[model samples]
Target: MHAGRDASDTLAALLADWQRARTPYRADAHDELAAVLVLAGSNADVERLNLAARAIRRQAGELTGPDRLYRLPGGRTLALAVGDHVRIRTNDYRARKSKGARADVLNGYRGTVVAIEADRSVIVQWRRPGADGPALATEKVSAVYIAVGGLSHGTAMTVAAAQGLTADRMLVYGMGLDPHTPYAAMTRDRLSAHLYLPRNVLESDADRARHSAPRNGAEELHRALNAYAAILQGDRADQLISPEPEPIAAVRARQREAAEQAEVQKMAQAVFAAAMLETVTDPRRPHGLLGDDQLQERISAAAAQTTALAKVVEVEQRRERQQAEQVTAVRAQVHAELAGERDRLATALTALDDAAHRHDAAQDRLRTAQRKVTALEATLHERYGGRIRGWLPSGERARLTEQLQQAKEKLTCAARRAEAAGRAEQAALRQAVEVFPAAPSAAELHQRLRVLANPRTFASALEKESAARVEAVLPGLADQRRVRAARMASPGLGDSAADRQHRARQALAALTAEADYRHRLDATRQRGEERARRDPAAPALARSRHEQAQQQAETRRRAREQQRGYRPSTPPGITAEGPRQGYGR
Candidate 1:
């Protein structure tokens, strides 16, 4: 009796019984816990609905302070009187998930009952709105929030059959707007009914129409009520009441207006599509759209652009042509200058080659002259002690001066002969150059001939000087040889022991006589001195003569001692008369 039927009337009867049999269970308590009505919906929609409920709770000062009101998606809020006995309960779907130990996909909301119905369904209002747009639109209607199966705008009872439980007011959703038994049962027994639906009504209708296809007797009742309501609000209500046809012109005008509206709608759709296309393709021309007319205009503009580019290209080509002509003239002038420079360089190269050849020939001649000079110097140095220096006696100096003068004269003659030979060599070289194609310059030929002549002149000078030096040195050589011969011929050079003995005896005799004479002189001097002292008046002139004679005698003795090389004493083993000749021999 309770499973598939409207449970409102059965629940009402039970509630009345419970009130009648009310017991004093809480005798010491003044208040009881209120039950919160919980609704279920899609997870995201339910979360947003929970947020709206929080907002409304803040605005309305928390209608259900401790108990909550969870108004989920496909569910709405209904404002009720303060005195109405409201209740809140946990949603059956959430309770099942909590029992299974799974996370709640939908949250619970607090609700209060404002009205009751013959069925068990109740009109529940919460603390907040389920969505922002509807909540804002009817936000001013602070005391009148409605719960329906659809959006807040003209909420309807669509899922009356699936409502199952009876409440104070209709709370149906997830069904179509077709004539169905569940929809009739939902709205028929209730005093005030509210419906909850999706954001788009037509989509909801399409979705639920299939499920509501099983119609019943409620379909005839619904059609009758719709006819009655249409007539009461219809535009031709007067004509319908009187039964007459409308004028032909008026019918046609109405048709025309409908057609005009359809055309306007088509044009608006096209404009919106173009605006969307431009938003994606061209931000600068947000309102521009591509069409046949626009494409034609763009083509014409592109043609003009092409023509402008062609004109620019033509101008550039003309300027390039003038530049080319100027370049050609400059190139011709540069070529002429380069030709003259090349000829000058060729002549300079020829002059350099000629100078190099002349320098080589001169170097060869100078080396030959230096070699000849070195050889002649070595020969003269070996023979004559060339370039004489240091202490020469007067006779040798005079000889050297005469010899040097003669050498100078000889050198002059040799130089003349060398000059003649050089002239002949120069003539031969000139003849050779004449035979060749490129004859050397006169200056170059003369310089080479001078180089060749230097060696011969230097050699001749060396020979003359060597001869002069030999002549100057010859007299000194003759004097040294004569002195050597005289020393060899002396007879004393061969004297032996007998001659030495005879000389010694003679020296001894001379020494004895000198001693006797010296003694006699000393006696005479002493006697004279005694006589002078005795006759103090002797003549000064006589004294001077006597002193002079004493000095003369001393000088003579020294002379005789120097002439004989022996002392007064004879050497050992020699007799005073002489040495014995045959003693050793």
Candidate 2:
């Protein structure tokens, strides 16, 4: 067989095998043999055959037309028809370092240009194929070449290169028009250049160099050459040489200026007539000119008028000074009145505070005296039986009983005085509020109210706090009393009557100490309740908080009892001697 026929048979058999198997064909396979078969027939020389094969290889893997055959980079043959399912395989490879410390492939993931990085790599992002929704992924690669077919939106290229690229539309963002980037991103069918100039981008020296006068001159020369060619082709001699006529509108502007000048002259004539009419007919002179004697008389009259005006100005100045003095006196008087009012208000508040302090002191004394009297009575009963009046001879028991009675009476009188003083202080405060109105401060009013208002609530809180303190200390006092009573009962210990009396005195001192504790607790709680009522937005909330504190104290007491392995015999707020009589009212 002939060599050309044998090559043809091999090519034909390879094409049939590629058709049977569904795969894409790559171009670099058997390049020399394919060139021989392609250049075999017709008068096509070797050079033309080489060019044809190069052109065919250039479009090997691209989508050219419907139902066309394409060869991918892998060695396979496949049909690239419409509605064909194509899969792109992405391999994650480690970067290979070059001699210049540059990466040949920074990343291989396919995507659009998300950013142009500082390291001269372009960040590309695109959706993963067959993903749910528009799921995106990014890769950083060299900005020299971009595969734009994979991106959903358009990508941006930083460098300007115009070869081996195709697009439908292009946009230049934050950059001026460069000579090459515009052509690189333009579509062959229809190209529209859209420029977006952000604050970071400005026309630089390189842009001016590409768009200078010499470049514009070259472009104009081309346009002139085209026009001359068109003229030679057309044969119209007069049309090319005719000069354009001057526009009539420009000549029409001078007529308007002339009319404006005429109107100004007419206005001048009218002003001259008005001046002639204002002038008086000078019978002594032929022309309208003033004489030297008349001019001197006019000047003297003007001087007389000026002197009278100066006198009126002096009179006005004197009146203004008197008014200013009156204003100053009125301002000082108002300030003095305000100062006097402030001082008076301060004095009244101080007096009210003093009265309140006296009232509180009187109440404290009365409670203390009452507790003392109660303690003395208990002591008397503990020392003596029903024969208390006859137990002591030297009139000592009678004197002690009389003193207790007097203390009770004094407590009663003190309570009455305290009540009266509280009422008087409250009345004075109300009168001040009515008389002063706006003169008193809110703080002052709040103080007065805490001291003088809601006496019942204050009295109730005081009673409860006092009762709690007494209840807390009562068990210890009762235990001491029990021990003393046991000692008295068991005389077998060989104790004397004086010793028993001394023990009784100690018990009485304990009772006094308990009473003192209760009094001090009441005073502390009273101040807390008063402040709570004065400042808080909700007084009831303050009261509840106080109750919580009381509950917490009770819990701690119970916890101590539990720790000591002793069950509490009495409920909270209840003493062993039962609730104190005449309390909580």
What is the overall TM-score of model 1 with all chains considered together?
0.20
Task: For residues 348-372, write the lDDT of model 1, one tens digit per residue.
Answer: 3345445555555555555555555
Error of 2 at 121 (Å): 75
Estimate, for each residue in 1-585, the C-alpha lDDT of model 2 and write its tens digit. 011112222222222222222122233221111111211111111222222222222223222233333332322222222212222123334234335343222222222233554544445444433346544444554423323222111112232322333322333221233334433433321333332222111223343355443244345334333333333344324335454344644454445435533533343333222222222121211121223344345445545544555565567557546544654554455445434544555566667777778878888988898898988788667655467544566465677688889988988888898898888677657655653574365366555445333566544544454444444544353354456577679866545334544444454444344334334544533333234334334334434545776788899999998878854454346569977434221
- Evaluated with TM-score, which candidate comes out highest? 2
Candidate 2, position 489, lDDT: 90
Model 1 ranges off by over 4 Å: 1-320, 331-347, 377-585
- How much does candidate 2 score in TM-score? 0.21
Which ten contiguous residues of candidate 1 have the minimum total lDDT? 28-37
Q: What lDDT does each candidate get?
A: 0.37, 0.40
